[model samples]
Target: MSHKPRGLRPDERELWQRVAEQSVPLHPERAHPVKQVIERLNKAPAKHRVQHFTMGQTARKIAPQHNLAPHITDHLMNNHVQMDRKAFGKLKRGKLGPEGKIDLHGMTLAQAHPRLLGFIQSAHGQGKRLVLVVTGKGKAGTGTGPIPERRGVLRHQVPHWLLSPPLGTIVMQVTPAHLKHGGDGAYYVYLRRRK
Candidate 1:
């Protein structure tokens, strides 16, 4: 059976009133802060009035803020050329054929690192000048998180790997591959002459 609502007993009601009267509010201002804010907002003069427009008028557009880092291609392009200018131009134009090539498309970071290091070392030891590293354009991520995820993991990391220890000393220039070689997915790695 459902219980019916009942009024507080006279003794209980008196006890409640006594307790309430004796107790102090921890945050008196917070009790009605929302109401205070509304009142203040109502009293303040309006700073930004809405503009009137006709039915067919286009809405004003705001320029988007660019918070993300620059593209990997831009970074590589901006880096000072370490090799010959004439050869660099030829390399960029796909004139210089890669003597050695490595495909690290589907490999994890752990797997790709050691393989990349060894490949570069071997290529340098064999007296290869230009090499091709194929790291396919990574899959798109769900743009749900606060910090945006970079598209290609290998594409971004490959440049850094070439520039860091062991490989950095031997590697002369690193550039994005031309369309025929593999657009943004591959790199043209030029190695220094063996000493």
Candidate 2:
């Protein structure tokens, strides 16, 4: 290999060094608007719809299990860019207390299965519209991040279990509750009212 001018001659390097150090400082006036930055990032995901199921599709395709009164269900089924903050806020404030609570902690799927089903039926029979099943934030079962259910075991399986035929009419839809109600750590399980 040819010897590239050994590094640059001192004067050549000095000129480059001076040029490198001279960065036109960011002018506050030229800074990008927050809206512009948000718009650009929002556009990126529109192209990658596979990864993000739009928190943006309000139609039937997005929320098949959405079943409440017509007006109420429509409000809940909103998949706008942001969850309907107002509706979520109201639900959070509203104390639709669970008829009973089940600690699914350390319980294997086989054990929790029947228990969960029975719990739903009892709640439904008792006219319990809301049931709080303590999946324990799904954290104890796996040592993953905050969304503990993403790991093997409970996280991957619970939704399927709930959606199957027996539990199908039992649970309406599961959604992350407001911060006061445990937020993502726990789900607000809306049970179907016994007619």
Candidate 3:
């Protein structure tokens, strides 16, 4: 059975009126623009015409999508060269060999930070110039959230750590390692000369 349309109850109408009076339009300009546009269209001649198109016609191109943030490697490369030009070139080309190396795989943030700090400090203290830091490319995230989550927490955080605080004073430059030395998953940390 179909129900008949009925007017709002007296109490319901009073409540609606009170709500309407207190509510504010989010966009006051937009509220009546549609009505104005409709009134103008009714007063004007229907001169506008739709373009003709066949079913197989090619569609117009859409604007290109906004790009994701620059890659981790890009961020590392963009940093100002803090070491000698010749040495930096060799370092990038994988010509410069690390005097020491540290692997930070399978460790929590708490365990990794201190270990990294100690290793860098020790290397600097021993007058080491170039060292390799291995922070394996992080595992892929499992979440399906709207905001994209980056994989490899250590890969991202290690650079910032090397560039800040007690380590920053001793560290000179940080660059991605070559394939033979675990490319993309490791960093070549150039340290300052021990004073």
Candidate 4:
């Protein structure tokens, strides 16, 4: 049940009236903060306005076709891998233990890129065939911001780096790690036997 507000006593009402009569408005001429802010914003010319693009439009602009042959390029144009039936079987079966492994967590692009190249080169030098590269499935971005945040930059970029020259020539194949290994956040890098 809703309760009504109690009526003020006669003495209380008189006291309230006296106080109200004595009290003058403080800063009655003051402009509202929100209004002032709106006025300032109206006066300023906005430099950057939001631009919307469809998926196809964005893909056309951001993703250009590569001149490289399909065989040399990974499915994502990131890494190159050619695996025969037996090699594919071995990798998928998780029969081969990673001779080397590198975790690329909490590292920025600048730090991760060079370290990745170095790790791969070193593993290749050691004649290691199967190695693991871990890139955590990045956190989902907060959707409120103007610019969209991309998740799993390394997950996408690592494949590209693996397919690029110098390392590409050495990297024989790359496959997504099995669930036992690291699932989506990791890769199984199979290197060519040292010549």
Candidate 5:
């Protein structure tokens, strides 16, 4: 990734307290941070397990039923998502464990971005609403740190990534998860089907 890794900003340093304590790499065997998971996935030359959903079918099938107020989509499309602790939850192991769960534990930002879009497309197509993405809060904080804070990376950057480029047009809104589902660490990503 070309993004510069600088020291964490004051705000990020604060965020580090919450994030660093929670996140863990998805693959224990790999021994790397979760943010690097995506890059490794791209280079592994083994398998692409993350499911992909198409844009067209999702637009035609899912968008019509979300009951999204006409203007809400537009507003979300053009606005910045203001994250608040009021909207997040920790995932219950029963509800979010395995089967249909998408494990983002070790995925890199680049790998996670496309897969997240496809996931939204697929879920939207299947007439599903209110999908959950489990982005860890982060594992490194201020003290005893080898990597500088900015490498704290995905902890704060994922939100911007969601609002940029190809994914941005497909998504209408994104908010921090509710308290029952890994709040602040996860996101409630709302997708918009094309008109």
Candidate 6:
């Protein structure tokens, strides 16, 4: 068999070694795509990340502050404008059914607020005496974030809203719903009769 060069000559091998050492690698170690994205996000200031109000944030922000006057229905009675004990008892006992019903679940405060106001106004205009407003027992929101989570925001707000200016004029009384009418998740709104 003819003799062949089994290996590179010493001079050629030395030249190849120098070239290999001097040349850049074909592919430098790339940072993982996810890692790169995380790094870029981390470089941003914290203020920018929380710049705008989220839906929950807006809801919590606009939620009516709790008031004691509305709750003390018996103490400061508005006899002419408020529901009488007999009518309120009938409502609480589920003897009187709602003439109309409106569900405010899945709606943010901005949406619910207007919708609630409109419903009350329309119901009053139509001569509907009693109505049901269902504001669901909200989910237990996460409290770990920068904004503290508030539960049952609508449940609290509906009563307060019903007792506020425009709505207060039309709404005669607001009572928690009976078990048959959604219990704690709803309110029995008694509207004033249009003369």
Task: Give the per-residue lDDT of model 6 (tens digit) for 67-167.
Answer: 43443233223344367878877887999999999999988888899999999999998999999999988786655666555567787677778889889
Q: Write the per-residue lDDT of candidate 1 for residues 30-138, one digit (tens) a residue.
A: 7587898999999999899779978847877764444378899999999999999999999999998999999998999999999999999999999999999999999
Instruction: Give the Å shift of residue 188 in candidate 3.
Output: 0.3
The C-alpha RMSD in Å for every predicted model, in order, reads: 18.5, 21.7, 20.2, 21.4, 37.3, 19.5
Task: Give the worst 10-residue stretch by lDDT in candidate 6.
Answer: 68-77
**Candidate closer to the true structure by TM-score (higher is better), 2 or 5:** 2
Best by lDDT: 1
TM-score of each model, paired residue for residue: 0.67, 0.45, 0.65, 0.57, 0.42, 0.57
Pairs in steric clash, model 6: none
The lDDT of each candidate is 0.93, 0.60, 0.91, 0.80, 0.58, 0.80
Over all chains combined, what TM-score does candidate 5 have?
A: 0.42
Candidate 4 runs further than 4 Å off: 1-81, 145-148
**Cα TM-score of candidate 3:** 0.65
Q: Candidate 5, which ten residues in sequence have the lowest lDDT sum?
A: 90-99
Q: Count clashing pairs, candidate 5.
A: 19
lDDT of 4 by residue, 1-195 (tens): 999999999999999999999997888799889999999999998889779866676454553333344422245324333767677777877877899999998888899999999999999989898899998777766646656555577876787788788789998788888888987788889898899
lDDT of 3 by residue, 142-194 (tens): 64665677778899899999999989999999999999999999999999998
The TM-score of predicted model 6 comes to: 0.57
Clashes of 6: 0
- Weakest ten-residue segment in model 4 by summed lDDT: 64-73
